[model samples]
Target: MLSQLMVLFGFFALVLVSIFWINKAVRMFDKLIGDGQPAWVFFEFTALTLPAVIGSMLPIAAFAAAVYVVHRLSADSELAVVQATGYSPWRLARAVVVFGLIVALMMSILAHLLIPNSLSQLRMREDEVSRNVTAQLLTAGEFLHPAPGVTFYTREITPEGELRDVFLSDRRNPGSAVTYTSSRAYLVQDPAGTRLVMVAGLAQNMQQSGQKLFTTHFEDFSHDISSLVSRDAINLNKLAFAGTPELLRDPQAVAARTGAAPGAVMAELHGRFTAALMCLVAALVGFATLLVGAFSRFGVWRQVLVAFGLLVGLKLIESAVLAPVLVTAALWPLLYLPSLGGLALAVGILWLAQRPGVWRRIANAIWPWWRRARGAGA
Candidate 1:
């Protein structure tokens, strides 16, 4: 049973991760390729995103594997034969519990190490890509809008790396607009930032309120263009990129560095643990749910639906607690409520599966009301 669970888990995890990864890759391809970036950059970005995608899909895959394995065993009468030999539901669930622990260990590694490192690397790469001005503005005879309210055009480019007949309009300022027309220009990078050094340029400033135009000519003038091309610089101090140990050791310090509230930091720290614990909960719920009621030749489709619904309910509970937890650090314990609730639910289902008389009694009590309602509707 353990071997079957492991095999199915790998298969389901691969299929799910591939589907989600392909979807994300498509959107990244459009954005990166459309921005004139090379194919290698697109591949690097997609590869960096794999850890996060795998992390999100593992719990679902584990749940599916557990459910499918149990369903197949019951369908083949293997479970029935085992039960006849006095193997209780709890005993049968031991393999499933061990499988869940293995998956939980995988989740722990991803949440604590791989995910944070990948996200940090991704952010750094994005910063580099955003600042690559040549790739963004090197084409000749075409107008470029590197940012909203900014337009740049160069009539020609010399092999010597000089821009000819450059025209630039900056309307980012609401009170006045500036237009710079230069006979020649060079892009310069310095310790400060990137700048466009325009020679023999004419600056035209137009006041929006009065529609007045003022013009000035210069031998050379430098205009800061870094903000136009790049986004805000990457801040590595973000809590999302911090290690779990760092977060737990001094959450207030982490909060200060990331400019988040202390409560938010605590919530993030606990959220990681809860995410890993959820893997165990998901696996157990899947196995225990299928163990309920008698096996049918028609299969346990209803039990599968119940298990799916239970997972959804757990997620809903998780979402519902997040806001309050974020508002108060003391409520950090609430983050584990969903996982705890799921474990309780799994235990309850397993107990019910062990007691056939209890199930019959409950069904008998509900069957009369179900029949009466059917007759009234008819």
Candidate 2:
């Protein structure tokens, strides 16, 4: 049973990860390739995103695997045969518990180590790509809008790496517009910023208020083009990229480094721990839910639906508490409530499975009302 659970878990995990990863990759492909980025860059970005996709899907995969395995066993009467040999639901659930622990450990590794590192690297790469002005502006004979309200074009490029017949229109300021046309231009990088040194250029200025135009000819002029490229300041000290130990040992320091509230830091730290625990909860809940009733020839589709609904409820509870927990560090314990509730629910279902009379009594109480309602409707 344990082997079957592991095998199915792996299969389901692969399918779910591939589905999510491909969807995300497609979006990234369109954005990056549209920005003149190479295919390799797109693939690198998608690879870095894989860990997060897997982390998010792991619990769902674990739940599906458990449910499918249990349903198959029940359908084959293997569970009934085992029960006839005096095995209790709790005894049979030992394999599932072990499988859940294994999955939990996997989640812990991803949450604490792999995910943080990948996110950090991805951020760094994105910053580097955004700051690459040469890639954004080096193409000749085609107009480029490096930033909004700015148009740049170069007629030709010499083998000596000089831009010829360069034209630039800057309409970023509503009150004034500036246009620069140069016979020859060179791109220069300095400690201050990127500069386009245009030789024998004409600068044309127009004022919106006066509707007047002023033109000036210069022997050489330098235009700051650094702002033309999008270079958003990368926050290297993001809380999501920090190590768990660093977050735990000195939350105040981490908070300062990440520019986040103490409550947010605490929420992130505890959220990782609870994410792992959720895997265990999901697996156990899926297994225990189907074990509630005796084997039926019709299969356990009703129980499977109940298990899915319960999982969704747990997720909703998780989402509902996250905001409050983030608002108040003291409410960090609320992060565990969903997991605890799921465990209690699983235990309750197992207990009911052990006593057939309880389900029968509950069904008997509902059947009479159901029949009366049916007769009244008829």
Candidate 3:
């Protein structure tokens, strides 16, 4: 069980990492590269996001490992011998339960600690990159787009960081466009932000509807830097940027991070804890679901499918209740519904596994209905 769990975890990690990296690479590369940023910036931005990705993947990895190992053991009759040796269904599931708890603990650490820090770092890095004028602009002879619909180009950049023959276009406003051409310009850093100090510049404004042009020439001009990049909210607006304590403390304030209600952050806090619990829940779902029936040499693939189906159903339930829970803290109990359901299901399955007579009674009650349904389908 240990060996299989380790192997499956590594396997799942590689598969998930590759999928996430490939999906993120194109966008990250273009976002940095289109802005004419360097390769290292591309790598750094994508790398920082990986912890959140890995954190989300851990539960599924644990689930898959448990299912695969249990199904394999049943197919090999290893589980039957273990059961014959007086290990009850739940007792035989001890290794899997231990593995599940270990994974759950790891997930708790990540959800409560590491993922938020990584997300915070990613947010800060993105903000810094956007604010960086040297990286985004100041490249001589190349057109630079500091923001959407905004472009700047300089014919030459001196070693002293002076811009010569600058062309700047600002079209961030959908109704009108502004363009600037200067003989000389240099960026000035202030507490507010970076500003362009242009000498001997010509400004042209054109309205989008009328295409009316207005031109002005000045010996000196200072343009505010704020419009050159996207402005983020004063506070981090991502739930992933806050830990459980941050989320629980002043729930309303943290909920503002997601523009949600007072209970939103509380739901998030409870969700993180419940999400960790779900790792164990998912593992037990796999273990218990597979243990119910007699062994099949062909494998317990049918039971595995049933377990997966149950998990999917529980996830759907979780999704359906999340919105209400976020709005009403009284509904916070819904956050644990899936985990509790899984636990109940595991307990129920173990009971059935222990009592073959009861299982026989259940099969007798429903087996004919199943056949009828199958016949109707056929």
The top-ranked prediction according to lDDT is 2
Cα lDDT tens digits, model 3, 1-378, are: 777876887798679867987798888897788775888988888888787778878878888888888877887888898889998876777777788888889889988888888888888888888777657885678887777898889998888889899999988898989999999998888888878999998999998888799999999999987666667654567776776876767777776657777667767788889888888988888878888777667788888899999888888988888988867887898889889988898889888888878988888999899999999999
TM for every model, in the order presented, reads 0.84, 0.86, 0.80
| lDDT agreement of model 2 with the native | 0.92
Which parts of model 2 are misplaced by more than 4 Å? 138-143, 153-167, 171-176, 181-203, 207-227, 230-233, 374-378
How would you encode candidate 1's per-residue C-alpha lDDT over 1-378 as one tens digit per residue? Answer: 999999999999999999999999999998887666899999999999999999999999999999999899989999889998999999998999999999999999998899999999999998888788756777688898888899889999899989999999999998999999999999998987789999999999999998899999999999988878646757898878999999988888899889988888988798889889999999999999999888689998999999999999999999999999889888999999999999999999999999988988999999999999999999
Which has the greatest TM-score?
2
Clash pairs for candidate 1: none
Residue 78 error for model 1, in Å?
A: 2.1
Question: Which of 1 and 2 is ahead in TM-score?
Answer: 2
- Each prediction's total of clashing residue pairs, residues at least 3 apart in sequence or on different chains, is 0, 0, 0
Name every residue pair that clashes in candidate 2: none
Better of 1 and 2 by lDDT: 2
What's the true lDDT of residue 254 in model 3? 73
